[model samples]
Target chain A: MSGLLSPGTKVRVRDDWPETRGPCHIRTPHYLRGAEGVVEKHLGAFPNPEDLAFARPASRLNLYHVRFVPQAIWPDAGGEALVVELYETWLEAA
Target chain B: MSEVLETPSDRLLAAVRQLLTDKGVVSREEISERIQATDAATPAQGARMVAKAWVDPAFRARMLADGAKAAEELGIPMRGMPPLGVLEDTAEEHNLVVCTLCSCYPRAVLGYPPFWFKSAAYRARAVRDPRGLLREFGTELPQAVKLRVVDSTADYRWMVLPLRPAGTEGWSEEQLAAVVREGDMIGVTFPKVS
Candidate 1:
C-alpha cells in the first residue's frame, strides 16, 4: 500500500466489510466506514495487523493520518474536526 | 452455590502471560521492570517540557518539530517508547488527543493512563462531539475557535503543548511548570496564571 497515496490525498473509507472477515482483524473503527477525509500525513508502513492477528505472514501497509470535518462524519456534529490513523487497505480514492 | 469468575480479558491476559513465561519469551522480572519504569513517570515530566518550550524559542521549535528528540534534550528517557507528537494549541485552534480504538497515550511522559481516558464514553463521544466533551471537562471555548481532535490510533503518542498563561511572562521555568497540570497537557483544560 506504500506509494499509493501521499499526504493531502482525498480518500473514502470502505463502507462494507470484506467477505473473508473470518480471521482477519481490523483495527479501524466501525464508525469511520463510509467516511470521507483527506490525508493529513503518512504514518509510515507497518505489517498488516489483519494478517498478523492470525499469526500469518503479513505484508507492510501504509498508515495515514486522515482528517475529517465534524459534519462529514455526523451531520449534527459541530465545527470540530477529527483526525484518525487508518491503514491503506481501509481507504479508497474519493 | 456459584462463585464469581474472572472476566474473559483478565483470563486471557493471565493465559498469555503464563504462556510467555513458560516459553521464556519474556521473564517476569523484565515485565516488572517495564511496569516500574512506567509508574515512575508523571505529568510533571510533560509540564517540564512545556515550561522549557515556553521559555526558549529554539526549544519550542524543536519540541514542535520532534517531541521525542526534544524530550531527550531535557534528559527525559524515551528509549523503547513510541514517538511523541506535540500538538501546539493557539488562540485559533485547540488540540485534543484521544485513542478511539484503545488508550494509546504518552505514558513515557504522562505516567499511567487516567481512568477517564480509557472510558468507553470518552472514546465514542470524543470524535463524535468534541466540543461537548470539552465542555464536560469545564473547557468552554469561544464559538470561533476550531477544535481539532487527534486520535492516537497508531504508533505515535500525542500530547498538547498548551498556550502559556497570560501574566506569567516573568515566571521561571519551574514556576511555569507548577502551573501546568495534567489536564492542560491533555488539552481538556488550560493552565491558569495563578
Candidate 2:
C-alpha cells in the first residue's frame, strides 16, 4: 500500500521518537506531566518501545497507570494530593 | 570596548555563542541552522505569536489546544514533527524541559532549546531530582511554587511559554515579545525589562 513507510524514510521523529524508553535515551514527557509522588500503583498494558522506536510493527500495545504523590512531583504539592498516569510505553522498571 | 555588562543583544549572543563554540561547549553548525529557521515567515514568526499570547487568552487557549495550528495562526507548521505540546509556566508553578536522554525539542515554535537543556547532567538529574536541576538553572522557587521537570523523549517534544512578567500594564505586543527571551519561554529565565 502507498501508506507503507519508505525504506528510505528519514529516521528522526518517525522512527526514533516512538522507540525510546529508558533512563539514557531521549523520551517523551507526557506520562510525567504534572508528576508527583512515587509508584503507589501500577496498572498494566502492551508492546515494547524498543521495537516501536525503530518502527517495528506490533499487533498490540499496553497502557499503564503510574502513581506518584503530588509532593514528589511538585515540591509545593501539599496535603497528599498526587499521582500520575504513565503509559507502559514510557517506562522501564526503576 | 569592554563594558562589564554592556554587550548589545546581538553582539552578546555572538560573543557568547562564539566563545562557547570555541571551547567546544556547543555545536555551532546546528545552532546556526536553528537561527536560520526563524524570521517573518516562520510560524513562531519570531515576535508576533509570543506577543499575541501575552495579551489574548483565547489565542493562548488555541496555542495550548493545537500548538502546530496555533503557530500556523501565527504561521508555524509541524508537519515533520513528532507529537508536540506547549507548557505554560504560570506564576504558581515553573516548568523545566529536558530530553533526559537526548535533545528533543519543538523547534518549529520555540526554536532550539538551550545547550544545558540537552546535557546529560541536566537530563538525568532533572528526572531523578527536579529541585536540584532547577537550582542549577538559576531558578529557586519559594517554598510555595512547585517545580515540574518534564522529559521530552522520542514520541514528543515540548516547550514552555512562561507567564508574562509583571509591570507591563499596557505594553504593546512587540514590547512584550522583545522581552520574551528564549530562556523565558523555556522556563529558564523570567522576562526582564531593559
Candidate 3:
C-alpha cells in the first residue's frame, strides 16, 4: 500500500471518486473504477492530469498499464484483454 | 458575424483566439502554421515506420523500445506531444487502441482521429465488443488469437504495428507502406495488397 508496485502486481482500481467542483477533470475512466487487473508496466511518473487539466500546480504520479480481462469487465464480452493507464493513487493491492 | 458564429462553443473559441492574439500570446500566423502542420501529418508517417519495421530488424527493435524516438529517426516531429507506445501485432496477438474519455490520438503520426474514433459508439463498443466492432470493418479474428484493447487514458498514446500481410513477402518498404492504411494501424482492418 505504501510502496511502488512492479509489473505483474495484482491490483484493483479504487472505486471512490475524488470530490471536486467547477469542471473537474479526471484521467481514470469511470468504467474501470472498481475493476481489478495486473500491473503490466510502470510508466514513468508524470504530472497528474487531473490537476493539470484545471491549471493547478500539479505533482507527478506514477502511471501504470494495468491489464484486465475483458470478460470480467463485461459479462458477455469477448476474450480480449483491456489495458488502461491508471494513476498510482487510484490502485490498491487486489 | 453572428451568423458565422453558429454555436456557443464556436463563439467561445473565437473569443479565446481573439484574446490570445490581442495579448500577444500567439500570432494568427502561428495558429495557422500549427493547423497546417497538423493537417500535413497523416498515416503515411506511421506506415513508414510499420513498413520499415517489417523489413528491418534493428529499426524494429528501436521502434518497439522507444516509439517517439523511432518516429523522429524517420523525420517525423514528435516534440511537445505525449509519449507514443507501439503495440506489435504478433501471430498470436492483435492490438487495438481506443480512448474512452476523449479522442487522444497520435496526431503527430496519424493526423486527426477519424470521426468514428471519437463517436460514443466506437468508444463504448471498442472496449465492450471489440471483435464485433472489427467485424463491421470486415476484420475477422479467430478465437485463438488474443485481442488486446489498449485504452489511451493517460500520458501515453498508442498505434498498432500490424502483422504484415502474407502476399507481400518480397515487397520493398515503399511497396509495403503503400498498403498500410489508417485503419490497418487502428486494428479495425488489415493492410492488404492485390
Chain A vs. native, model 3, TM-score = 0.88
| All candidates: DockQ | 0.62, 0.12, 0.81
Tens-digit lDDT string for candidate 3 (B1-194):
35553899988989999999999999999888777778878999999999999999999999988899999999887767789889999999999999999999988889888899999999999999999999999999988999999999999989999999998989999999999999988889989878
> Where does candidate 3 clash, by residue pair?
none
Which prediction has more favorable lDDT, 2 or 3? Answer: 3
lDDT of each: 0.87, 0.56, 0.90
Q: Candidate 1, residues A1-94: lDDT per residue as tens digits?
A: 3366877889998896763565446778777889999998877788887788789999988888899887877888854778888899888889
Interface RMSD of 2: 6.9
Between candidates 1 and 2, the DockQ winner: 1
Question: What TM-score would you give candidate 3 relative to the actual structure?
Answer: 0.90
- Ranking under lDDT, best-scoring first? 3, 1, 2
Show model 1 residue runs off by greater than 4 Å.
A1-4, A18-20, B1-33
List the candidate numbers ranked by DockQ, top first. Answer: 3, 1, 2
User: Candidate 1 — number of clashing residue pairs?
Assistant: 0
Number of the top TM-score candidate: 3
**lDDT per residue as tens, model 2, B1-194:** 87676548978888989998899977888566545554323324434666788799999888776666777776465555554566777767777666655677667766656678777786666655666655666766665776665545434456677777778879998778877766666656667776
For candidate 2, what's the RMSD?
12.2
